[model samples]
Target chain A: MFEHTENINNEEYIPETYIPTAVSHGTKELWQVFWILLGITVVDFIIYFAMGASMTRNIIFILMGLVKAFFIVGTFMHLKFERQFMILMIVLPALAFIGMLVFGLLHEGNALSIDY
Target chain B: MSTHTTVTNTTPTWAGGRSPFNVSYGKLMMWIFLLSDAFTFSSLLVGYGAIRFSYSGHPVTPWPDPALVFNHFPGFHGVHLPLLFVSLMTLILIISSVTMVLAVEAGHRKDNKSVLKYMLITIIFGSMFLGCQAWEWSQFIGEGARLNENLFGFTTEAAAKAGNLKLFDHVHWDMAADRTPGPVPFASLFFIVTGFHGFHVFSGIVILVVVYINALFGTYERRGHYEMIEKVGLYWHFVDLVWVFVFTFYYLI
Candidate 1:
């Protein structure tokens, strides 16, 4: 919410400007992200071992993985403060690749036997 | 003529650090390079997935059970080690990334000593991870895990010593029996591809060590910037990103 984009720069001078020795977030917010990551990873384990159809489980896991991946990319990678153009530059290609994977998956099932 | 003098003396060749890309010169290039490398790794993992499924079933098989096949060590005479080694590698990479960040910070502060110290730490970490990967490769190659075929599937495991083996044929689950193991071609492929990636980590470690040596000699200090640290950090993080896909495809799925 308190995102600032002006810090993105190409300054040539090597100055130690605004280096916070112990920069940290409030416990509540930090813990929220931590728990979310933990919860998703746990869900990943479950969807994997949940003993459902492999196709269904695969979808679930992929979606969960993407969710976790975005949280990590946006928050941990510090892309939240970036401008919209920068955000799209970083994310859109990955999304395009994911789209290809989904399409490939649809056709890939032909490679496997569908035993009921 | 007079204007030429003014332009040469007054106009700045450098934009004083402005770019239409809206990111630092080093950082933006890093992002693009990482993006390209991401596709390379993605294609490798996904191609493996496609081929593995394509041969989901064939005649003469002891289908590779990832759980049983990828057993790595946490200790001696490993009692069916899980993907713990991969996790350890991940931890090492993450810690190195942290150290690299510290190095970058030190570079900004012109703290040459701290920069060298942290970069050295990072190089050590990258080498350690590479060592771990080499051990994993040895285990894979040793004991002769081979690409096998059976009635239902083709998999990586020890092939039949003398007879034509078929799918679902009964063999001892333990490695002690039927020890006529040979090099699995698929296993070799896996080792080569992943091994080369590990080699890159090794290469990066060596480069970092060189950079540390240079930092000790006041190269960056005299040059007046630590942009090299940022560039190397990019290379390091790209390595980590590649592993994320490798984990999901190789270990989990």
Candidate 2:
């Protein structure tokens, strides 16, 4: 609580060491983090326009997308700083749903009945 | 039962000057709520994916081409502008997240002015995002756009082969066009769920404006600190995170 602000005359603004990532806190390299974010976005754009077969393009994008997502969630969202149990709680359901999605998308075309 | 008081540690002032990332209780609770809200949206979308599975078959309706649907932006002609509006929405959300962080910074410094400034910016961005969605909904639901009525009738499966354009524009109504839809089906579900999420963003903006107003009046200065900013910021970030999934599953897919 800042109950002592009135007594301190608000003269001293406490310098907070902002923590965005899970890494050990020290001096912040703000520019470094910004550069990384910009770089990843550009790469994503490039991959979208790159001339490649659908499968190849999709595979590359998926992998790169996961990496980018990890950076955003870990650094930007600060989820990386959370406990392992928190991580599992956040990730497990998504993984499960994604598995079902992939399976249904791939197999249903062949497996679905046509009697209707 | 969340209190707005900022945490005070008895471990002296030498410990990294009050951990910003230590995260307050209110923020954590907001996150937990957001997580539950996330599952609700995903279930709605994934369920939409499954039930609308054979869009090409049954009472076939050609869906509208989402790209071709909103290709105009007041001045542009034939822009091929797919995903443009949504892309801007994504950027706006990102920028709002940045502003929210700035507000949190201001809260740490006990600077009410900067706190109000950043919170106002966040409110403005949130409103704009919702406004964009309103435009999209108008363009989609207005003027004969059907969830199940295409030129091909029930051959939507075949129509889907023609491309994403024809698939979106066409829809096939089960009973008669005049008959009321029975208990809100898939298309209804899609709009309702995403609409509800957008409504949350809308409400969050209102709450943020109230918090900003309190900050402007120097309310927090009187009684300790402004943890409301932190709580609201968490909600803002959660909104951003949810949009990522919505963009991926609903729009991109």
Candidate 3:
């Protein structure tokens, strides 16, 4: 294990001047993700206006939403850079809970449906 | 003493060590907080869906169509622009998220100038989004949208036929069954969900401003890392992500 105290005392480990990057691979990657998200949103908008409302169309919209969400979470949040366990620990549980909410609410909605 | 020494717990549980998850503790905690907040938002949205969809039981219930209600754009009076303004709002938020991520990336490289620049842009974008939302809310209120009741008529046909009916005319209210709870659930849910989201956006803007000031003052530079930017970037992205769902549920669908 690296010792923080030892590292603090090590002159070689210390950089006297730190200059952040104006353009780096990470920035380029961020732009790529941004464009992709923009593309997805535009497609979703086109679909939204071009097509009439239908179950299939709604599902497609939602799936595209999920896709956009995945990218934002993976890249913007930088979850992809984290350990897999950390990713799963945060994502899986929240997803499971959200799934529960969707299903449970769907059931409730049906129960409250006048047709029912 | 035994010939072979037995090793007990070598490190105290509270003792600091390398991050087990290979991420900073502050960043990890922020993620956890965001996850919990995600649950909070999901619950609110689900509740909105349940109540909003549940109104299917009533025939003459009035639920205003989001498309028709949100059609007005700034300086375009009487010109309907379905999803245009809201879409613009989404784009602005996404752009801000992009700037925020850029800020984080700059932080990673220890580029204080870039971090400050990107963070400033992010804050500007966030503030613009909030301004748009405020305008949107005013439009809703100006158009007689309410949280507790439906000012619009119940059925367009009924309202048209009955000249005395003030609430549900074709010139005003769209074809929705206005009875019982009427548009109460819809209005309340709209206000609640979007209001909560608006609060989050406002908070994000404030945080970004604070972070921007810090960046300007060489706070993060002195700390030798831009982890604050990364943490706040996570929050800003989360806000944008929630808006995606909100736009879908409240506007599109």
Candidate 4:
């Protein structure tokens, strides 16, 4: 059998600079994500005028922002196509930290408002 | 060497001979950097939220309504046009992101000409977004939105008038009569968060320009890969992602 492992010992085998060949996944999915994002932004614009500023409205806007973020990160950044471990490594910690900050600090802020 | 050969056909992903994530080292590092950047932005946003919430019931200097402060659009002075210019800016950034991803896709195909074309388009749109931000900042500052103090605290009379305002309704803002000193942190946070975001967009454009020049010189073609385009594309899209939240929390909410 051909010895493929021997190439690792070769002088050309520089692990630090190793770059895997990239493949074109075409632009179809990218365009779809773009439209979804644009559509959501439009909806956000319409909703702002249609509804008064309230907690529900703000929650809706935030949810839509997350949806837009999903498309941007998953497709535009190609994180969706990456290995599962890579996705988990980047996503899990961010979710945990951001969630903690939002809940914890907002609660504290609410307490401060009560005292004020 | 014999054991290595035996494992070659079924090499585990973590066997140390390859990238387990299956991405280039540069791309992996870019993701890590972006993750850190995300945290920085999150902290800023959370801070803004906390500060704004703390001023909820201030009798003298209430947190200003964004609609009153951000209602001006270019060529329509004295008109109530909330969310119009910012929506345009958001669209610009989104379209630029699309073009950037297109450039990366072109790079994947090794189509240097197409890549250059798309990169130029992305740069133009990015610069347009930056210009919009500059105009918005100027409008804010021109209306007395200082970092140390806010001038958007409308009197009860002005608040009543503002409540009746529909889009594009022309109304003069007599700053001296209409408003008082308001929450200091409102203006400061606005400048800090959006300024940081605008700076990111600016740097992304500069990076895009450098990459465009490199592509013009056939640098990636000579290297037999276009991962550099992918790396920059990640940064550009990250800027867009940040803008999405900024629009939501700063304007809509």
Candidate 5:
């Protein structure tokens, strides 16, 4: 229960550490992102059944997954509102690591395919 | 210090007091942690992919068909539903993430009532997803799948040749023990990857429950900013995003 107080100058009363400066994402924007994510996921579910198994389907699934990941990180995680430097700091290293894994796996596959 | 003489009034470079990213220390650290965690997951998934693609076409036991393997829907009683339940679980997780973001938005507006309400909703949704996951795991184990063997008949040489393996047939439960200790990477990888992700979901639920209790106690109200909620929101979204990858590799692929 919060105490009721008159319009007293509470500047000195409030603790410095208690300052609230979180960026306000509008309610409408939040809902918009939510809908976008749900729609994409539904489409993803549908595509699996529609396309069955194929190299193309696998590629499409990966691309669509990246798209969904982008939306979740950009909107729900609030990465879009963050500064460019911060975004680069996170995204660049992650991409680099993923690239390394992909290329490394490809090389391994090539070696495995060759019979002695 | 007493002997030091001031040259310029400007702040020292070493001090660098301001946040380089214009964000709080807690948030910056959370991002770093998530990035490292992302690498860990990527490595595991990539390793699974490598092993699977290499051996899928080989004469050895083929990778198990995810559709045939995970076709159990709760309470449907022997009904075969390929990916219907997992997709529903994904949707629930995404919905929980939406509620989490809404809670952060409410916190930004300093609307304590809305924040608490949204946080509670998010926690409920997260709990539901975990419940579905537990049921799915139980079905898999009950069907005789384990780390040692792929219970699915198609994952064995003889069954692959016979080509008449029914999904979730109780008769084949003994067939798992009959098969030689062939390459069952599918079973091992399925358990490892999903197990790790399940652990994350479990921990996320625990953290969300704690956050919900704090919200009920009006702790965030006193703190003036629900940065804690925002941080947890980052984690929840990451979990949701990771599931996208898991669903793609484990189910769709």
Candidate 6:
């Protein structure tokens, strides 16, 4: 139920409910991302068997997980095409909060183990 | 009306009358919602890490190794296939994500036929993943993993034997000989984290079905935009994103 009106200056004026037209952007990039994600997953599987359980292996898995998150959020969710401000608004807060929680609580857990 | 000016590179992003994110109100809200959801999941995972770490030096019942506990595979009875079945589940979720993006891409072109097709495929794969989770949970429960207790703990002898076992070897659990009660939080956290992620997948499937029905009736076609698909697509992708972390923290580590 959007009202269509012509501005006096002949410029298209987008109203509050304005939804810009959807464009196809083709499926090429989507497929490329799919392949890259699958490839990294395969690497994850291989490394799991190839390496012993150690902090190094665990760090590798966490780093690869972050890389996968980049693709899924950037391309699959279409955040990469959004405005710069929007990207920072979503990404920065998450990194800060999650990072702090993980490191802080894990240190606490390690201390609890020592006391036991 | 005459005061309105065309948006250009020099225009201040926060100026009124337009979306600073260049997304519709609904899609932007979906992103915000997902950001909040991410925080919720992070808390659960971080808590899990803390509890697990605290169990490291328990003299009576050391923390159970995940490989020994989650080694069963369908049709391969007693085989020690750690990480294999969950790996299959990961593949299913990732493939379904691809189909969902394809559905959104089809929506972009206003191709309702292709949209419905891809949507159906995505829903099917989503359900398939749920089925796998159901089986995995049944196996865990059958082995006496409960929210209040963990029966997967091994005696020193059994733990030594488990360390020497190779892939594809038969894994027989002798409750009396091998298992003692384990850290209570291990079983509890497993259920809470995976259960939460599973519930999200279930809800995502329900939402996708509703979106698919709407498209079948030409709702998006009549509305002149397929942004609904895009919005729901964002939610579905968010589900997949959460699974990546769950798979990493819960299973792989």
Which of the numbered candidates is closest to the native, going by highest DockQ?
4
| Model 5 DockQ class | acceptable
Error of 2 at B40 (Å): 1.0
Kindly list the per-residue Cα lDDT of model 3 for residues B130-219, writing each as its tens digit. 999999989877756688865543455544433442222233333344322355777778888999999999999888888888889999
lDDT of each: 0.59, 0.57, 0.76, 0.89, 0.77, 0.88
lDDT of 1 by residue, B1-253 (tens): 2222221223232344333334555566677877777777666666666656644543343335454456556453545544556656766765676576667666767778888888988888888888888787667656554334112122234343213332233333345543423224346547655865786787788778878888888998897777677567667756655665566666666
Compared with the true structure, what per-residue lDDT tens digits does model 5 show for residues B76-171?
765556778888998898889889999888888878899889988888898898888889888877766789876554435455543444434433
Each prediction's TM-score versus the true structure: 0.68, 0.65, 0.83, 0.93, 0.84, 0.93
Report the C-alpha lDDT of model 6 over A1-116, residue by residue, as the tens digit: 12223233443447557686677879999999999889988999999999999999999999999999999999999888876788999999999999899879866556667364
Q: Report the number of the highest-lDDT candidate.
A: 4
Error of 6 at B143 (Å): 0.2
Model 1 chain A TM-score equals 0.60
Instruction: For residues B114-183, write the lDDT of model 4, one tens digit per residue.
Output: 9999999999999999999999999999989888978888888888998898887888878889888888
Q: Report model 1's interface C-alpha RMSD after superposition on the true interface residues.
A: 9.8
TM-score of chain B of each: 0.75, 0.70, 0.83, 0.95, 0.84, 0.95
TM-score of model 5 vs. true structure: 0.84
Candidate 6 lDDT by residue in tens digits, B1-253: 3566643344454666555666777887888999999999999998888878877777887778888888889999988999999999999999999999999999999999999999999999999999999999999999899999899888888888899989999878788898899888889999999999999999999999999999999999999889999998999999999999998888789
Best-to-worst order by DockQ is: 4, 6, 3, 5, 2, 1
Consecutive 10-residue window with the lowest summed lDDT within model 1 chain B: B1-10
Off by over 4 Å in 6: A1-16, B1-11
Q: Write the per-residue lDDT of candidate 2 for residues A20-107, one digit (tens) a residue.
A: 2123232142234435544654564455435432556546645654664565566545567665555676678666766676666567
Query: Weakest 10 consecutive residues, lDDT, candidate 3 chain B?
Result: B165-174
